[model samples]
Target: MVVLAGIQEGKDAIVEEGGIVALVEAIEDGSVKGKEFAVLTLLQLCVESVRNQGLLVSEGGIPPLVALSQTGSVRAKHKMITRN
Candidate 1:
């Protein structure tokens, strides 16, 4: 999904289908790897698109992201920081 999100069409389809909300939910409740995947997908989805960025925020994505940044696995933290 992260790889797919890198494509414009893939990202738009995901967003149109409410994937942002789903991904946010995953970030809130998923396992360590799941959270990392969610954040990476969201990063790709939001990368040059303000609409997706706003959608991510509207879905309450920030608090969970902050928590993940602080307490998630070291790999996840590195991924978030590097946006990779």
Candidate 2:
């Protein structure tokens, strides 16, 4: 929840400081609420900075996000679309 709140407040450093990896892990393995928050946070972070987008792509963030888009909830898929 801290990550989500941080991202919402435009904290790219949170993502840069390994938060992206944790979020990706959550998308892959966390509960529904976790995945939702993770994806939403990532989307917000990516939207806030191109650097965070690059960081996400470089950290192998795309595949899991694509996977989540394919299999996750409607909101998750929507978040993925917004991220792109």
Candidate 3:
């Protein structure tokens, strides 16, 4: 998912297939590495897409992302705020 989120086309496909929620779920319940990867993938998905950013917040992505930011590594916290 992280690799797929790297390209615009891939990000589009993932979003079309509802990847955002999956990524959020991963962050909520995944392993340490998985959460980090999910965060990175979400960052890629939201980087240049305001629509995705809105969808992310609408789909309940931020709380867990914020939670991850609090408990995750410094790099993960960095990734979370970088979206701003």
Candidate 4:
């Protein structure tokens, strides 16, 4: 649950390759924090990470992040939608 712990810790700036991949895996595996608050917290971290680093478009992070952005369980899409 490092990813969940990470999000709760507010360390969104560390969405590096390994971290993002881990989060995505957790999300996909249904092992991460399933609570809406936890998921939304992770989502916010992701969005802010991309916005701060501008890596969403340049580093092929968009596709995966877009997929991550579409968990379909909340209203995060309204704030930052990714449709790749």
Q: Which is the leading candidate under TM-score?
A: 1
Backbone clash pairs in model 1 (N, Cα, C under 3 Å; residues 3+ apart or in different chains), count: 0
Alpha carbon lDDT of each predicted model: 0.91, 0.77, 0.88, 0.44
TM-score, each model? 0.96, 0.78, 0.88, 0.35
> Which portions of model 3 miss their true places by more than 4 Å?
81-84
Clashes of each: 0, 0, 0, 0
For 1-84, candidate 4 gives per-residue lDDT tens digits of: 335434535454445434444444444455323433334434555543645345334445456446646753445354344311
Note the residue pairs that clash in candidate 3: none
Give the Cα error of residue 25 in candidate 3, in Å: 0.3
lDDT of 3 by residue, 1-84 (tens): 888888988999999999999999999999888888898899899987999999999999989987887898776777677752
Q: CA lDDT of 41 in candidate 4?
A: 39
Winner on TM-score between 1 and 2 is: 1
Off-target runs (Cα >4 Å) in candidate 4 are 1-9, 32-38, 49-84
Measured with C-alpha atoms, the lDDT of residue 74 in candidate 2 is: 87
Candidate 4: 10-residue stretch with minimal lDDT: 31-40
In terms of lDDT, which candidate is strongest? Answer: 1
**lDDT agreement of model 3 with the native:** 0.88
